[model samples]
Target: MAYAEEYAPTTADPARIGYALVPLLDYFEGKTLMYVRGATCRGYVEWRTSMVRANHANARTEARRTRTVSSATARKELGVLSAAIGFWHREHGPLESVPVVTLPAKPEPKPDVLDRSEMARLLGGALGFYQLEWCDLETRQLHRTLKRDHSAINRHTARFIVIGRYTANRPGATMKLRWMPNTVGGWPDFKRELLYRKGSEVVESKKRQPSVRLGRAALAHFRRWKAIDDRAREDLARRTDGMATSFLCVVHWGGEPIKDIGKSFVTALDFAGLPRHYTPHVLRHTRVTWWVEAGLSLEEVADAAGMTTQMVEEVYWHRSPHFQKRAAEA
Candidate 1:
């Protein structure tokens, strides 16, 4: 399920790599006439075949060997040139499969966890600069950028990040803008309807949807963010109507929505000087780790993170090796 982001791992046959790349063939149909008139030769055909094969590196290698192009130069041209030729041939008939070449398995790397001190530094760094204020050195451009223009956009971003990090929802499930406004009403509303009801959280052929309540400290931080959002929206004519009709998150600011916020999380983390891996998903992992360290039952952490208890135990339970080692030392 996690591998869905990289590949369509759900396909019944994994051997036909880019089995999902099948549907994309339609897009190339428009380019058919241009390719048919272009260059045709042993070198071009070999290189072209490699491009269609799916493994990018192999395509480059085949192109270099066929054309006597240097290894370095071939890599640059492989994707662009090979793709052009491949699209041309797709209209005529099915291309032959790339020869399967298996390499010996390498040792898998162990997963690493941040120590408690490192975790403290990350959260501290994030909060220390949460209220964004921009300054221009040359002109003294001190302006309140958080004005009436983007209030709805900011609230939506806050809600998705808050709910996704707290709940560990998959991107598809959590990024759906329709469900967000109801969830952001906070824990009381969440607990009354979403939890205890079995199917309330579960989507068909999709993962269980858990309702996550923030910690006392996290809730305090969120309340501060909400206040800022409210002030930003206050200047608009008829602010109450704007709040009532629009979704908490919308595409008002530069045509961006809350769903686009995840990309910006990495840039924000870089600004805060935290490790690059400290993205929103890392916060999800950190929440689960803290619950386990605090002696919450595995089942509780799993439900909170929208996963099976076994997954939480398998992924994060070993994070605090010091606690286990302390028992033996004692």
Candidate 2:
């Protein structure tokens, strides 16, 4: 699987050559290849030769969908295999003496997604019994998990959910936001937040930046969070003037910053008996699908999500189950 994944994307037209095919060398790890029926000379070579030829042909066809580089990689692998087989046959005996073995094709990579209902259920579970407070918890708690208390747990969940839904931002972007709270200082007043990007730019670090925006619910949530934060600062200022840039979310022990929300997210998932595939990015995929299903124009969705319309049309269209129905209507 690793070998195929590593080598399959080299070509532009991979369908002619199946990149998903796994070589015996891959499964063996570092083990040497064996001639199981070295005793029987004639049948082995022909079978091995036929298998190798067929494998190459299949690989060539599949490589069409992939890049030229990936196809080249598969070809190079075949060359190595051919050279090795030739050496083995020459040293031992005729080509007829080797055994035949088939390789498995590499499976096409696809986005793993949860349907809207499943996503709602997953979020609900996280809100109550899982660990995170209901979605209404302070947005910052999503990243802070120093004490592992209920507040910390709920907060961490909310942060991740926000990352998943509003922006296609990676976990690192969330970390960046948490590290620089002032970036989001002006509640509702995004214009003043010069440190942060207007929309998806805050999250997208990819070479090609996408446009992203928060939905009404998401925007309202952040507005409320800002209000709470302002109130916390006011309370702190009243108590003492010596306080430093105290965080909006802090532990009872002291105003120390919480750390390790990502790990806690994983821990909460395990506690809930959910599949290991539950990552923050998966939620982003879910949101994109939701928008597409809701009948947003591809360009509109892309603008809202801070992405090129082409990208949304190409990569994410399949994630929505309603894509076919929508396309047919169009």
Candidate 3:
């Protein structure tokens, strides 16, 4: 609790440490640091996996069952425990020795990418209306309606998709962007055609959030969004006697910032006739894949995607058209 609170304000994710620590606290209750060993860590992994799997088994739907917890989650939780112990030792120590926390092998990355046609379909779903079916309770009749009356159905999600696809930013970093510069979230500089993807005051995490230059299409969308937001703000100010204000780049119709778009994104996927397994993170993957396929140098792609060159070579170079071309020719 102390370590979590201490680093909460500085971390990009304020709740992650605390959330990971909850199960650890429950399991390690009354146990001293001396009791923490490789076997104990492995035991915790088993216990946590079984508990979550049991709950998942009780879920009534296939989708819910498929969301079972993996060993990766257990590894993260135990990593938090290890970090907490290390912090304690550094800050105030007299401990004889610290036990190493055992972790499961890292899982292989999922190979999922959206092709150009699929990308277009996804954007269409976000920007256009789709048919919705519902059963009328009184008449017991099935009805289909074109859901075009409400703008909230997919407007914010559309912006999210465009930004995510262009910037190759993580979903969280993309959603945290704003039009105006601030200390709490990233902001775009339209004149410079650059996007600062991390706040000035936020401490950098292992996952980098480097600035990226915007493409012409992305810049045009940002300009249009700014104009729309400015018009909306002015109208709201007049209606409320100059009391309305907003700074977020991605917003609903009324200018309120959207916290999460998972459900709406899934709806867009359904509308586009795509798989539900394609998550928002897949946008980043798609962008990286496209870059590699275009024969962009590893250094350039790594810098744009805020990843190390080694990672790009290891994980994405295989997608390149020129990959092993010399060897194949020989």
Which one wins on lDDT? 3
Q: How close is candidate 2 to the true structure, as a TM-score?
A: 0.48
- Candidate 3 runs further than 4 Å off: 53-63, 94-96, 128-152, 251-253
Off by over 4 Å in 1: 1-202, 222-234, 237-247, 250-256, 277-279, 320-330
Error of 1 at 196 (Å): 12
Every model's Cα RMSD, please?
12.9, 16.2, 5.2
Q: Write the per-residue lDDT of candidate 1 for residues 119-160, one digit (tens) a residue.
A: 443433333333346788899997542222232233344444
What lDDT score belongs to each candidate, Candidate 1 first?
0.43, 0.48, 0.82
Cα lDDT over the full model 2: 0.48
**Order by TM-score, highest first:** 3, 2, 1
Model 3: worst 10 consecutive residues (lDDT sum): 245-254
Give the per-residue lDDT digits (tens) of candidate 3, residues 1-330.
667877666776666787788889999999988779888988998888765454457678986776656788899999889888887777778557987888888778666899998887787677666667899999999998755425535788888888888888888787778888877678889889999988889888777888999999999999899898888888888888866666456545458776677888888888776888788888999999999999999999999999999889888999999899999999
Please provide, for model 2 over 1-330, each residue's C-alpha lDDT reduced to its tens digit, 9 standing for 90 to 100.
Answer: 322233323322222224223442542346444643333222323333334343235444565323222333443444444434554566555666554433223334355666755565455445544434334366544442212335534554655566566555434334334323343211123444222322322222232333245556766666666666667767788788755466444211133354445455655555454675466567766777778777777877786565677778887766555578756888
Candidate number with the higher lDDT (2 or 3) = 3
Query: In model 1, which range of ten residues has the least summed lDDT?
Result: 98-107
